[model samples]
Target chain A: MRPTVHDIAAAAGVSLATVDRVLNRRPGVRHVTREKVENAIREIGYVRDVAAANLAKGRTYPLVFILPASDNSFMHGLNDEVRAAIARSSVERTAIRTLEVPAFDPAALVKVLNELGEERPAGIALVATDAPEVRDVVDRLVKDGIPVVTLVSDLTGSQRHHYAGVDNIAAGRTAARLLGRFLGGAKGEIAVLAGSMLVRDHRERLEGFAAVIAAEFPSLSILPVIEGRDDPEMAHMLVADALSKKGDIIGVYSLGAGNRGLIRALKEKAVDRSLTVVAHELTTHTRAALLDGTIDAILNQDAGHEVRSAIRVLKAKADGLAVIEAQERIRLDIFLKDNLP
Target chain B: MRPTVHDIAAAAGVSLATVDRVLNRRPGVRHVTREKVENAIREIGYVRDVAAANLAKGRTYPLVFILPASDNSFMHGLNDEVRAAIARSSVERTAIRTLEVPAFDPAALVKVLNELGEERPAGIALVATDAPEVRDVVDRLVKDGIPVVTLVSDLTGSQRHHYAGVDNIAAGRTAARLLGRFLGGAKGEIAVLAGSMLVRDHRERLEGFAAVIAAEFPSLSILPVIEGRDDPEMAHMLVADALSKKGDIIGVYSLGAGNRGLIRALKEKAVDRSLTVVAHELTTHTRAALLDGTIDAILNQDAGHEVRSAIRVLKAKADGLAVIEAQERIRLDIFLKDNLP
Candidate 1:
């Protein structure tokens, strides 16, 4: 049988109330008494039944999800996942509400975050805009004893508790290697596409992609990156122009969400050209593109996984508990047509 | 507040005892009463607090994991993951024990299954041998109300509830495509490596790989399969002999284990030959090979995820609950050197 509060009390030579206070991390117990109770808990191998404890206490986590109001498939999917989580709030003992700030607007993100300090939720998760002011506000919230985690895109130089996303740099490097090996020893220009240069994820991806290409595949030179702002029409126009102007472009690495645009450009213009392509995000469009041979592979981060991880992390932090890091890791899924989930 | 058993009883116009009997699937409840309780549960959204309910009953799940006693890295890793799960049995309220039968011995596997009927575990997860005797025993267990799931290698035409592994056919097809694309129209023979033809996964992988090669890459031809028994020494000897005898072989697909020996063979005898290689399972040796350019790509099914998913499915089955199919899907992870976890 598992040890209980009585066992800890007896071991620590303390009263049951003192043991309960120590177990709950309540501030009333003196340091020496708390340490004694803690040591007793360790010695007796006592484990708290957290679910039962929370049920008795009628505890509910009020969580706020701050999302970028972006007109992109990925962001929309992220929002949908959050909504799904919200639907489970009653059973999960969570009260989740999502706040949408203007995309890439650091000032607006900071404003929302500062307002959260007044009506502080148990935790906050956001797609960070990678600005100094935003980082400062997040750190302040964390300092105020609120759990904060970055979703999808992470803040730079921040003390956020966790990141619920894939390693963007590694993703970019993987893309480069896939493109390089798929193209063989063909010496040609490779076009790079991005959502924006302002986001840290995009910049990191570009950096890793360029580093790998420069070091390993010297035969292939990367053309200037085209910022599409995750807009399909803009991406299509930009990619089409790049393809038309550069007949030597033999490959493409799209490291962002406007894959519908990228796939359209490839199908319309590059159908006659034997250009190998690798793109990001596994949406309906990207999956079809991969299946039809328009795109070679897709590097994907499961939105469900990211959202779930964020929620799990937030709950754990609120409970003063640690999560198994391996279980919490958001793996980078490399999807080929054969292994599409 | 979430609805409770009291609420379910009031809504269903039943006694607390009737609600309890229906909720726990006790044999005493009438069909009409059980249906009323179930309908009330749905209407009032009375989700069971499974953990708390189990805690109240002091319930513990007795689970059995049957694995093949194969001398290979992948099986060893699988064993490790099972042991890890066993270590967490106390907190998870599970009593998990592992049984290792001789590899590829259907009779031995059947004998173990027959013995488990006497023990009567809540759930059974086994790496099936794909023989009729094994299938029959598994069917009998299911008939007796045991929840059985196939792990890693699946049983063919069995009454198993779920297969907690990747689609071996898809894995094989993917390997074929990767090798075919990497070869780039080179008219050469491809060396096929296997653990054994006795296993379903190996045979299915070979089948899918061959079909894709025949349909897509006509220039590439597959050589005879060399069954390694997943033994490094046997794999090394056979792979070395194959390479020495066939100078036309420009590609290798190591669909099963013993990749350690395959890497050694490639390094020793095929160093001068530029053979595009694809292998299964992510081990230290295979990962190093991929990083060092000895292996082109590694197609891996995370053993940890499989084990965890099996446990989860088993628990859900024991509880007569459903799992999120997407969350439990064992994805085939395509690990390039750049995206190595």
Candidate 2:
């Protein structure tokens, strides 16, 4: 027979009630007593059967997801996936709640983090605003014995346990390489469209794109990025204006969301011109654009995978269990018109 | 206030013991009695918590993996992933066994399937041979109440519950587009390499590749396929001879294994040739070749993902539960030098 709570209690020289409290993580157990019980359980090689334990104790993992209040297809898709997870809350024993804050506002994110410290949830997952203040709060939360994971946009130089997103730099580098190679010795300028450089993912993408373009494709020159703030109207206007002004531009790389406007601009301004385009995200607009020859390639991160990975990592951390690292890796999905899924 | 087995028993007008037999799948209950209990479960919307039930009964799902005895990097990687799953058998509550048979031998596969009827494993996952005999055996297993999943390669016109692999046709179509566009307006013949035309995946890839190239890329023409038998010596010899003879061949597509041999052939014969190559699978040899410009792009299926997905689907089927459809999709990973991982 497997080792039981009774065995743990015996080994720890503690009462069954104390063992029960420690096992269920209930209050009123002294710190020394808890450690003693934990040590005994470890020494006895007791495998805590989570499914049975959850049923017996009604153990629930209270997980919080902090997202940006950005109106984009990607963000909407992410919210949908979180809602789906919420629907499975009963079966999975997870109580998930979402909090949205102003995009790129470090102070707002920090305020939410501070509030979460008081709530003491089992785990917290967030799209971090890459700022020192946000990092400080995240580090503080880790120090306070909370499991923290960064979602789509990661927090740099922080004590976060895991990042449930792709390598933004590699995504950017891939975009640059695809665009550069597709152009194939064509001497021309390239236009870059981005939501904003303030966010770490966007910045990292730009950095990688620029680095690869400079080192490998010296014939193709990169023009200044058109920051449309990920708004369709703003992106359309800026892209159309840029395309009209830059007649020598042969390629376009949309490194961030809001591709609806970019597609509209490409069709209107670059229809007669022989221009190659690469983009991010696989929204309906981008998918159609790719099929119609407006975009050559798309580099995407699956929002569903990110959300699921975040929840899995958070749950594993909560349970003090190691996750399958390879399984949790959010692979960058590169889609061409032929391989769109 | 969730519905319990006792509630089900009361609703079904059966004894608690009868309800327990139906729930645990014990062989004592009559067919009509089982149906009544099942109908009661459905009517009351009683959710079966697998974790709790597994703990109560120590239920172990007996899953068998059938693989081809091919000595290649991809097959080796897949075997490693299966071994990894076997290592986690205790935590996952799985009793996994693997059977290897000759590659592309449908008769051998059918023999194994016929023998498995007596053993009656909870689930079976197999790399299908795509023969009528294999399909018939798979259908028989499904009819016999065994949950069946096709891994890596799928069996067509069969009753397999799921296919834990990529869409090979899409992969081939994407490869053709990538190769076609990368070559620009250059008029040349393309060399097609394959392990054999017997497997469904290889045949589908060629079909998609041919259709796309014929429909879109008018300037490029395909040469006769060189069967390498997934052997390094055979692939190297055939590829080297083809490159030597077909000076007009500007691009190459390796739709199957033996990429190591292809890489060696490229280095030995086409060292200075500006040949555009697209290949399947991303092993160490292929990754290095991609970085060195020997292979321009790599199309891959995550073996780990497929293995885990098969296990999850099997477990869910055994427990009469539903799987998250989107979560179980095995995506095709497209790797360029810039985004190797």
Candidate 3:
């Protein structure tokens, strides 16, 4: 049987109140009496239950999630996950609130960060833009003893305590391999689609994808990149324009959202020939495209998993507890039509 | 501020002790006074803080995990995850004990189920063998008011409260798609390696793989399945023999945890040619093989996630609380060399 405070009290020949004082590290216990209680506690193997103790002390964590207000399915899904977290906040003993700023606006993000720094929340999680001002603000938060976690698009050079997202570079390289293997020695040009070069995730993915394609599939040439800004209409226009110009394009690799536009363009232009397509983010549109073979495969980072992981990390950081890294590591999920869920 | 027990006592015109008695459902409180206190509680919207109450009551759930005693890497990883859970039991307010029965022995599994049912632990999580007797035992446990969760392998036609694993059929279909796409229009024989047909997961995966191959890739033919029983030596021998017999084998799909043997066999025989290999479970061996270009892709259901999900589901079931189905759903993860965690 595990030893309790009462057991320590009995072993030390002291009162239960004195033992409680010693256990809680409260004042009003003499050195000799404290030493006796400590010795008794040491004699018996007793591990204090941290969760129970926190509950008994009525502890609650106040956390903030800063997200980019983007009109993309993936960002909407991420926001939905955060709202789900809020719904579960009472049970988890956390007061979670979300702050949304304009997407891709580093100055707006920095301004919000400065405002949050004044209040000093227990922790902050944000989808960061890799700008000097944003990095400075993140470092300031860490310096002020507020744990910051970069969610989704990470600001790697910043002092963010953790990143709750997949490695974009690896995801891109995987996409390249899948596209290359699926095409199988077919000599044709491959077109690349991305949200913007400003976001670190997009740029990193492009770098990885280009490197793999150049190293492994030298037969297949890559066309110039099209920056879609993750806007469906803009992506569709850009892709349609590319397809109209390049008659020999046989493959398309989309390393961002705006798959709706990509799908529309494929439906319109690639009707003559079946093109091998690999896309990122499994939204309703992407799922349907995958089902109908318009898109061959999808590389996904689950927004729900990312939000939940961020919350867990923030809670652990607040308590100075070690997280189970294996459990917390976000996997880059590759999806085909067969394994949709 | 939220209404506290003090406010309930004041509103109900009862002493603090009487309120405590009513709240705790202790004896000696009159029916009229109990109704009054309950009415006061309802009037003030005073939802009981369950975590604090559990702390005061010193409640700890004793959970039992029944696993297969197999030397396979997946089983070892599962056991290690359970041990990690046990290490974290105190903080999570759970006492986790593991019971190992010999692999593929339904009688031994049934015996352990009977013993666990007799003691009636708060919850039971098991990698179930889909036999009538095992299903009956699981139903009996549920009828006896015990929560039962089927882990890695599920017993479908049973009253298990939850299944904390991926859909095996989907996983198999995924493998078929990957192999079919990677081997792109190549007319050659594809070999299948399974643990056993008696296990429902293997059977389901075989069914899915066959269905997809028959419908989509009629060019590629599937050979008779070789049951390796998830033993490394047996798998290696079977695979080597198959490779020796079939001169035009271009692909291999392993839907079980015998990749070590399969890898050895492939290295010994098929060293000159690159075969499209799709395997299940990502252990250290599989990860290394993937990085070194031995294994092309892996379909993995994370053991750590499964163990943690089972515990969460069990605790929720024990408390008769609703679970967030989306949060609890285990994902089927697809990993290539580049996207490996």
Q: What interface-residue Cα RMSD does candidate 1 give after superposition?
A: 1.3
Whose DockQ is greatest here?
A: 1
Ten-residue region with minimum lDDT total, candidate 1 chain A: A47-56
Residue B308, model 3: lDDT of: 94
Candidate 2: stretches off by over 4 Å: A1-46, B6-44
DockQ of each: 0.71, 0.69, 0.63
Question: Candidate 2 versus the native: TM-score?
Answer: 0.94
On residues A1-341, what C-alpha lDDT tens digit does candidate 3 reach at each position? Answer: 45677788899999999988988779999999999988988888666655666767777788999998898999999999999898777778889989989988999999999999999888999999888899999998999889899999898688888999999999989999999999988999999999999889999999999999999998899998999999999999999999999899999999988999999999999988889999999999999999999999999998998999999999888777788898788889889999888
lDDT of each: 0.91, 0.93, 0.91
List, residue by residue over B1-341, the lDDT tens digit for candidate 1: 78999999999999999998888778988788889989999999888888678879889999999988888899999999999888777778889999989988999999999999988999999999999999999999999999999998898899999999999999999999889888877899999999888889999999999999999999999999999888888899999999999899999999888888889999999999998999999999999999999999999998999998999999999888878787888988888888888
Q: Give one digit per residue, the lDDT tens place, for model 2 in B102-189.
A: 9989999999999998899999999999988889999989998899999999999999999999999999999999899889878999
Q: What is the DockQ of candidate 2?
A: 0.69
Clashes of each: 0, 0, 0
What are the per-residue Cα lDDT tens digits for candidate 2 across A185-225? 89999999999989899999999999999999999999999
The better candidate by TM-score, 1 or 2, is: 1
